[model samples]
Target: MLDYLVFIGTGVYLIMQTLGGDKVRGLTIELVRFTLAYSFLWGAIEKFMQPDLFYHLLEEHSYLAMGMDWEFFVRAAGFVEFCCAWHIFSGRAAGYAGIGLMAFFVIAAVIPFGMIDFIGHFLFIIPLIAVLFTPRKVPLCRTACGTTLAFLVALALYLLVAYAAWYMLYFYLHLDLFH
Candidate 1:
C-alpha cells in the first residue's frame, strides 16, 4: 500500500519536474516533500504500533541483527523516522531530513532485505534526491499559530488519506496488508 503511494507520487513528481517550468518545479518539490514525509510518518507509526512485527523481522529476516532487544530497536528506529518525517513535513531542514531518510533506507535495504528491497524502494530515491538538491524555502506557515494550525491540518489529512487507502485495499480489494 505504501509502496503504491510512493511509486505513484514519485511518478507524478517526475512528470511535473520534466515539464520545465518554475511553478512546476516548486510544486513538484512541495508535493514530493509531502509524499516522502507521509510515507515516513506512516512507517514510523506502524513500527511503533506493531513492534512485534518488527521484532519478528529482526529475529528472522535481518542480516545485521542487533544483539539488544528487538522492541527497543523498533522503538528507536520509529523515533528516528518520526523526527525525520517531522523535519521534512515542516520544511525545516528538509534537505537534511531527505539525506537522513535516504541514508536510512539505503542501510535498511542492504542490511535486511538486500537487492530486492533496494529495487522496491528505487522510486523513492528520486524524490529524496530531488528534495536534497532543491533549495529550502520558507514553510507554508510563518507565524507560530499558523505553523500549529498547518501541522494539525496536515496530520488530519495524513490520517484521513492513510485510512481511506488502507480501507480500500483491505475491505474493497480484499488484500491482506499486514501479512
Candidate 2:
C-alpha cells in the first residue's frame, strides 16, 4: 500500500528530475540531503540518550550476540551517523555521501536480523535511487556508470545473503519482544 506509493512516487520523481534538469531537480536533491541529515542525527541522539533501550533492541535483533559489549560500537555508530548527517544537511557532495551511507546501510542491514534488517535494506533504496537519478553537479561518465552498477550488484548480493540469514536465524532462535 504505502510502499507501492513510495515506489511509484520515487520512480516518477526521479524520471522527471533526471530528464527535466531544472531548479526543481536541485530542490529535490536538497530535500533528500536534508532528510538524511535529520534522520541520522536523530538516530544518533536516540542511541546514546537511551542506552537501555538500545541494548534491549540489540538483544531482540538476534544476529548480535547477547553479551557483546556494544557501548563503543553504539557510540561510534552514533558519531559516524552524525557526521554523515551533517554532510548531508550541508548539501556538500550529497550524492557521494548518499552513496557511501547507502552502502554502509546495506552492510548494516545484513548485520542484524528481523524486520529491522529488512527496514534498513528498504531504507537504502531511497538514497541509492536518489543518487542514481539526481542530476549531479559534475557530469557522470562511463567510469561512474560502471561504479554505480557495481555498487548495485553488491547491494543485491548482500540483500540475498541477509534474507537467507534472517530466515535461518528466525527459525532457530526464539526472539522475545520487549514491547
Backbone atom clashes (below 3 Å) for every candidate: 0, 0
**1-179 per-residue lDDT for model 2 (tens digits):** 33223344455567768887785777666555445445555566655554566677676763453455688667666666655554444444544665577566756666556577667457556665565555456432236465456445543553465457756776667555322
TM-score against native, each model: 0.70, 0.51
Q: How far is candidate 1 from the true structure (C-alpha RMSD, Å)?
A: 4.8
TM-score (C-alpha, index-matched) for candidate 1: 0.70
* Candidate 2 Cα misplacement greater than 4 A, ranges: 1-23, 60-68, 91-98, 114-116, 132-179
State, as a TM-score between 0 and 1, how close model 2 is to the true structure.
0.51
Best of the candidates, TM-score = 1
| Span of ten consecutive residues with least summed lDDT in model 1 | 61-70
lDDT of model number 2: 0.56
Cα lDDT, all candidates = 0.69, 0.56
Q: What would the per-residue lDDT of candidate 1 be over residues 16-116, giving only the tens digit for each residue?
A: 77776677877777778778777777887677556788777776756544566667778888767766776666765544854676567655676556787
